[model samples]
Target: MRREIKYSDNYLIKQLPKATAYVNRDLSVAHISDSWLNNFNFSSKNVKKNNILKAFPTLTTKWKQDIDYAFLGFKNTTKTDKYFDSNIDECWLEWTILPWFDEEENVIGSIIQVADVTENFLLKQKLEKLEILIAVKSEIAKIGSWEYNAVNDKLHWSDMTKIIHEVADNFVSTIENALNFYKPGKNQRRITEYLDQSLKNGATWNDKFQIITAKGKEIWVIATGKPLFEDEKFIGIIGTIQDITEDVLAQQKIKESENLLRTLINHLPLNVFVKDLDSKKILVNQSECDYLNLTSEEIIGKNDFDLYDDETAQIIRGEDLKILNTLEPILGKETIITLKDGQKNNFLTSKIPLFNEDNDVVCLMGFSMDITPIKQKEEQLKLLINISAIQNKKLLNFAHIVSHNLRSHTANFSMLLGFLIKEADEEEREKLLEMLIDASDNLLETIDNLNEVLEINTNPVQEKKNIHANTEIGAVLKSLKLLIKNKRTHITNQITEDIYIKGVPTYVNNILTSIISNAIQFGQDISENKIEISANKIKGYTIITIKDNGIGINLEKNKDKIFGMYNTFHELEKTRGVSLYISKHQIEAMNGKFIINSKVGKGTTFKIYFNEND
Candidate 1:
């Protein structure tokens, strides 16, 4: 027989590790474990023979009723019972109530076993909350889990997975049916390969592809699987499936948009380029590469300095930096560029700063249009306009001369002849004849001047040669040496030997002679009369300036008619305005300009602009 050992109920109860107590039918505490006293913060001497409910004042009527059921020969237990001690601290308790029997086998009281299970109960509650949270997150993300058991040929889908497949809750799915959900052809074939690989070699797979749900709706899904193994034996595969239809479609649209933009940029006729903050080229369209006579590979990542001369590069880089700093756009700025082939071109360029989502300038975008053809056309139009203006002025001058000068001369001749006819005395008749003769000579001179003006207006200068400015001035001065000496004028020719201009030599000489002659003729009667000639180059023009200290007219009064034919401001009888008018027309015909500056009692300065020699 097994060694029989017996111990008193109190001894066994006291020896128990759990918080235990034995109570009588009257709900009195008969025995209490050391753990019970320690758990309840009660001393053994204070609660050994006391009523259970009285000892544990926190025990409510519900506890008494449970004990009553045990007294009636019923066994009752509470897995989680809430209790609060005198300190108002909450805990979870487990209580077991069983009927106790005496030697007669009749029920006496109940044996109550109590345990403080707050830690385990709280941990179980936390696990339940976590499961609920995970379920909520999975539903929101359109993600679901799945498992396949190879041995049993069984498949399991989470509720979310079923929902993603657009199936009812009661629907059943096998591995084959689940594979069928993938769209036919490439998607299905790819998924089948992944599954077979995982099953054979215990591999893992992650793929995003299209699928057809049970509702016959086509959608995109990202599926992932990892082979499951137990003791080196391949059991099955567990994986996740996500409904990524919206995300995939959005990505496709974005890709299409990018491609469309690229195509449009490449096909555009305008040069387009993008630069980073460092002023390095990051992007360039086909037109930009063509404009620079470079390939995209050569141009990309390069700054202006790498492709252009130092001066040109500095200018371009400066503009880019300004745009970047100011976040302002430069629009329709006309620029001229000289290419490698010695060809010059014009462009209308615009640059704008590109911004990020934060509204800060991150880079810059530029557009340049080849405006060379347009610029050429504009130059031609300007030439035509100048020609038209010259022609119009010439016509107006001719009409005025005919209407006023010619008519005046004819009227004078008619008057003089009528006077001669009316006169009877031989002396008077002879005087009238002399007057008519003088009038005829005047008429001849006027006609000659008019013809000269008309010739200069109608003939456009075609052949022009480079004439040294100093040499031409010397020639004019030599021709006017006698006139200058007679006037006691001091003349200075400051034109350098290297200064040259493009014009007909004869016209250049004539223009200088006219201006110098006027200086000599209009000077005050003084031995100190002075005239100075100087020439210099400015931009594309050679400017010849003639300054003279002479009896200048009041330009405020005579400016409009200063160059008019036969309009003289001085009282000198030999002063004819034809010289200056002819000089002005000659200069214009040679594509030159004449400017005059004068003040009464001061001096006159004449500036003639001629195209500088190549």
Candidate 2:
């Protein structure tokens, strides 16, 4: 329903006295002032001639009896109303009704005045809640509040405060009594001085002091006070004080234990230090001073930059900042530091971040432990390990080649001798003898190959030269001419004469000879024997690709053993299988990569990558 808006009460309300309002004994809509009408959203056009209960449905008609009683010459009647409005939540109203009279002193009507007590009522409610909460907190925490009013010259203390002071519940408080409660010595004088200066300069203070209670017992307490102000003018001091005797004693024990630990650490032989977020040194022990060959005074307040060279200092500072940001500990950081005297020292260091109660990194604490002797021992072990690895590797390869070759030779001899024993003709015996000689020769060649590998490893750092690839390929081809003619092999060489790579000449020749020979021997199976050699430079490395139409090795079945010592996949040709293994090692030693990619029926492709710098 749309209610009609009205403002007829505005003119009549403006004619009333400051707060004049009188209701007839009916307790109907009394005259309301313009201020009250504007403030309370009331209007004569809306509320006049209406009962009080109907105008503001929150009221009771029972108030009309009090209005009638007040008009019967009784004293003014007062009442407070508390109710909830749908729009305004909680509302508090107070009204005072007095007997209204004419000049003839006859009681006529009841004059009523109203006050919106919402603010004061809400404040009273909050204070009640706070008092209950304070009571709970005080019991649990042993803390209390107090205030001193300089103008009234009175000191007020909460119940918790009185209990802390060990005073009677009804004890009369005075400035003299308060001051006297402090121990007759420094506590009294200090508190007196603090209060005088605090009042004079309006300064705040927070300190721990001992107080002599009413029972003459000495106890420590933390007292904090701030100058109370009204309109920017200092009035008095008010703050909280907590009995901190137990906390103070615990802290003292902890401090004593910390001192003992610090002394023990300083005596031990470790270089320990503390630094702030800005990398400024905060603490350093005797060992750190001795290590730096400087007094503590010289080392303190200095950062890594002030003590070490820029590069080393920056490396250290970076780690420090990382710890500060992460609040994490970094352990076992090893580095070599060169000092101002040009003496290099090896140190194993660690850092940890210090934090406050809020878990924010307050500072960083780290220690540098000299590990020169341990590092020296480590280097020695590494050198021995290197020598052992090299020797073990060469010995293994030698054994592999020797075992395969010796077995081949012995088997050939056994077969030949058996054939000779069974033969009746002298011609057959002579042929078997010749075959034995060939077997022994192959064994000797295998031994020679082992020797060559030994030499290569003995001087692994053999000096290399820039050699032309096409010339090397041509030489290998010419050397294998008889085999190539036997196999009916066709060769295609695409290497430029000027295209160069760095490698040992003997090794390079051996690699090309072995690969080319394999191509010719295996390509003999194909109807048309074919081989192609090409080279290109990509990304500073010379890449050589060798392709051939041949019976490609089935890498799927033998992939794992392809470069292993004495490992062979083919049975069509007599082989000792040491070539591929040694070639791979030698190529890698020269900072090159060796790759072979092939399929079962498709031909084989070998790619070699040679580093230009090598």
Candidate 3:
């Protein structure tokens, strides 16, 4: 057995409280501390030369390699203190072997030191895990820390902190030096105030400010600071800094974009607005106020109820709430209250919900356009469609009636001629034959008139043809020379000779003839009648005026029925009513229109609109 010695007897061994066993090259336990026996359950007897493998069979090969290296005069050292079985609480001990020599200078057995470094190994593992955690959190937060020790007057910065400051390697730092990096004025004063508060009141602060870097770059930063402590004694202020320049600049750009959008909307032709649901305040464009004939201040910040009846106000509020709840847009025709005089007007409105930063519906933005003219046109179209349908049915029935009557008359004439041809006596036969011939001629004339009426009804009333207005007017005047001479009607054409209109030439001539002949026929009881023709071009159409000193229409009683077929205002048998009806249809088919302006006992004016050949 080796002599037992106190662990404290060797200063080197005593310093290693966790060191255990020392084995030699011969596989003998030369040194074993009390810690080794208690830790591994092994003593000198259990760790003899021949029994070394038997005692710790798990460490046989590793121990033999150490002995062989020691015998070769090579130092064998190892470090391993790993937990093999966490459930069993089993750990390992590492070894170092060194050869010992006698006075003859020949190596014998080597000395081996075994150490138990489990606690320190575990502590090192924990520190590595902490470093990994810090790195991960710093990246996620975009934050970094720094501190200046006032007592030692030394500065320290974390890796992430230096990266945030955009500082160069040559830069030197101290408490005063760091504070000086803040931009002058507001930023510097804010940082000074926070530092003072931290020192005087042990306070913590969070602020955003601008800083100038060593590279002469201005950056926006958010910083937080709190007083640091060691053993209940204040040392200095420790804090974190984050680069927020991109975020700040992005916010500024958003504000500018919003301002530009507002300018565009205010100047648009349509009215636009946003309304806060909670406050009921309207954010409207300048056009909205102008459209309502009111000032912005008068219409803003007031609910619809203030400017409208209870029913209308409730309806608008309901619609707004519906949009808010569904977060969908409202589109269609609507009526809105005007701020001026509180009149209700129609609008084509579309409204959508506007969400706040959190994606919650906060208000509604709406666009509107005036559709009053369209509404009126829609009503007029409804009436016209009804009239057209009625006219179609009546025209069909009238054709059938005319055809049946004409066919009956022709059949009677044919039967009379056949009977006359069969007469026996010469005188009687001659008289009967003459009567049959006369009847046949009369039937032929009636059929010709009927066929002409049918042709007028079924022909394509208009075609696209450029007509020289002045040339057509001259031709009509030449045809009406006899009437003009007998009536002594003085006519004046105050129109440019080069004026032309896009229309059917025949229809244009027919319309001009009808108007001119009517003026001649319905002239006032005067020695001489006067007619004036004039033209004015507006937009894409020409307005032709035919003013006549004739007995005017009694518009109060005859306005609505003036264009109806077979309608006659004059009490004259010659008024067949076909000419005016044909004229109206022909003019309409050419995409032109006619209107009469007249008063009883006053001269009449017929205004015709024709495409100005633009």
Q: Would you list the rank order by TM-score, best first?
A: 1, 2, 3
**lDDT digits (tens) for residues 522-563 of candidate 2:** 774655688999999999788888998787888878888888
Better of 1 and 2 by TM-score: 1
36-123 in candidate 3: lDDT tens per residue? Answer: 5566666546665444445445566777777787778887767464434324566665767677655565675666566666677777
| Alpha-carbon local distance difference test for all models | 0.85, 0.79, 0.75
lDDT of 3 at 504: 76
Clashing pairs in 1: none
Candidate 2 weakest lDDT stretch, 10 residues: 1-10
Query: Model 3, stretches more than 4 Å misplaced?
Result: 1-19, 22-25, 28-78, 81-83, 86-123, 129-142, 163-165, 262-331, 334-345, 351-366, 370-614
**Against the true structure, what is each candidate's TM-score?**
0.70, 0.47, 0.46
Tens digits of per-residue lDDT for model 1 on 192-238?
A: 99998898888799999898988999999999999988999988889
Runs in model 1 deviating more than 4 A are: 1-10, 55-59, 196-206, 227-235, 250-398, 420-441, 467-501, 512-562, 569-575, 593-610
**lDDT score for candidate 1 against the true structure:** 0.85
Model 2 ranges off by over 4 Å: 1-20, 25-38, 61-76, 82-90, 98-110, 123-158, 192-207, 222-242, 274-283, 295-303, 310-335, 348-367, 371-614
**In angstroms, how far off is 8's CA in candidate 3?**
12
